[model samples]
Target: MASVSVSFPKYMSHIPTRHAGHLAELCIVPRNLSLMKQGSVRELRIVRSSNQTEPLIDCTNKPSDIPLLSCSEATERLKQNREKHKGKQQFLAMYSSIYGGTVTDAAAMAIPMDDHMVHRGHGVFDTAATMNGYLYELEQHFDRIIRSASMAKIVLPFDRETIRRILLQTVSASKCIKGSLRYWISAGPGDFQLSPSGCNQPALYAIVIEDQSLFDSKGIKVVTSSIPIKPPQFATTKSVNYPPNVLSKMEAEEKGAYAAIWLDEDGFVAEGPNMNVAFVTKEKELLMPNFDKILSGCTAKRFLTLAEGLMTAGKLHGIRVDNVSVEEGKRADEMMLIGSGILVRPVVQ
Candidate 1:
């Protein structure tokens, strides 16, 4: 581990930033944030987080061996790389507030490297599902993203109505009827700094990703995550700070599970990495954990409303949102995960 002396406030010290010759390293700064004078500096060390001692790359290439390219040369290389790595899901269109337009070419759809969201994780995002030329629960998702942006302290790049229109136009331009529309609001491109104050302005980015596969109702295995859950303040916000989520998912995958489930500080069922968890109890109640400690999932909320019809049809006894214990959840007759991306997926184990 490498250490650096920082002169700024100590609160900003824990943020791990990229440094030379390593994936991540910790630098200490001040905690109580205040306006700093010139040369008030923070020290950073680019250190590896993992235990692996070997370098990621062999010592075969050097700075002198690299070839510098012009703008057009870089664009051509990006296009070639994109074409060579095409996958099942297609990126149809993207809207960037930075450029004030939509781009159909995947090579052209890129966010600035210095965007606070890119390096500092100062952003919030949400997604809408498109089906048969219509956006499902677009209003609700849009509202949630706005709330998330507010919670993340990222100002909207444009008014709500204008943003909505831009989203609609991006999806329309894509002509993708059976996919999802994802968008982000970031602190915008600026110098790489922990504070968003240096950002020139906020930015909005939207992309349409086309998925042609039919929905599968298959149940999947899940495991309790060893990774700790985030605090309620951060957990409830759909921000781009997803390192915990990513690690939890990786843990589940390592255990041959679909997704890892997190428990609250009190050991009550919280949620999956990216989706809401729901259970159908033996008594036929649609049971879900309260949203005060987890993300207020739009798809999960909509499903709760739709499930009301099932109660009317005598399929469910009632619906309840409360603290669900692990034993209680495990004993439930049916378990499922709900989210915009996965919709409703049954969990078998």
Candidate 2:
């Protein structure tokens, strides 16, 4: 029979002064042996109390020793572990200013794990594309995110001007002329509770991701989404709760389609998973679904504004925003999905 002994740091054996009479329990098991194996197992349990002497349990087996790691050694081990996945790090650069702190290393950008947004999905986000060092629709997207944050009850960590500068600085730091800048504003870190009352403040994080896919005007195909459309409240806000959107996109890919279009409960065509859908009728009239129960897309709005020129040039007869039935969309002369990521992709089916 093997003997076993258990030990702990002297500091852990002492009870906190605040909890003078409380008891502490510690259990130690052999690291090298499988607990499930058919062997008589013995564990050392330590009990500490202010008024009682520490008690130790002796077992048949000799104690298996465990080495404690130093802080530097632990940090090196973490770095080595992260280096193993260096190839999978996709962001070109990132910038974060949590709790009004200045921006730090892009490579080490991170949000607090305990942030309310991380666990409760109480956050809003937005993305804008950078073209030739210019952030397309940056102000528009920023405004939208601000509105979304208000709807989510998240206070801004910084004012509008400061946030704008941070975004621009992050993009410049990335040094990518053509990429996308995505950012989030989250309710700050605190106790892991259901309510935001425990949060200390709010946080803002931004990252620049390389998207080299060139614009392709070629028509693609899409199917109506099997995923249900979000209600009007959630649909209008660009929050981080995107499980439905992700599932819808996955559904499209599984069906061998470019994207999926969502329809409202009433069966009116709403929008694509991450874009706005537009249709051109045989009469050369452009029709887009109303934004009442869908995200008001910046790129889609820009496209509509630009398409007005086509109307003036007689390239299109008219433009209208109203409810679009699925049958009407299916029979339109042309259909398109418009968004910042894709610009404008015509739909063949």
Top lDDT model: 1
The lDDT of each candidate is 0.88, 0.82
Candidate 1 Cα lDDT to native: 0.88
Q: List runs of model 2 lying over 4 Å from the truth.
A: 1-90, 99-107
lDDT at residue 277 of model 2 (Cα atoms): 93
- The residue-by-residue lDDT of candidate 1 on 1-349, one tens digit each, is 2233345434535645443223223222245533223433322233345443423333322345568999999999999999999887899999999999999999999999999999988999999988997888899999999999988888899999999999999999999989999999999998998898999999999999999878888889999999999999999999999999999999999999999999999999999999999999999999999999999999889999999999999999999999999999999999999988788999998
Q: Mind giving the per-residue lDDT tens digits that candidate 2 earns over 7-102?
A: 434555575745532322333433553432255344443444433434344444544577599876866766676566655234667776663443
Q: Per-prediction TM-score, please?
A: 0.83, 0.77
Q: Which candidate is the best by TM-score?
A: 1
Worst 10 residues of 1 by lDDT: 20-29
How many steric clashes does model 2 contain? 6
Error of 1 at 255 (Å): 0.5
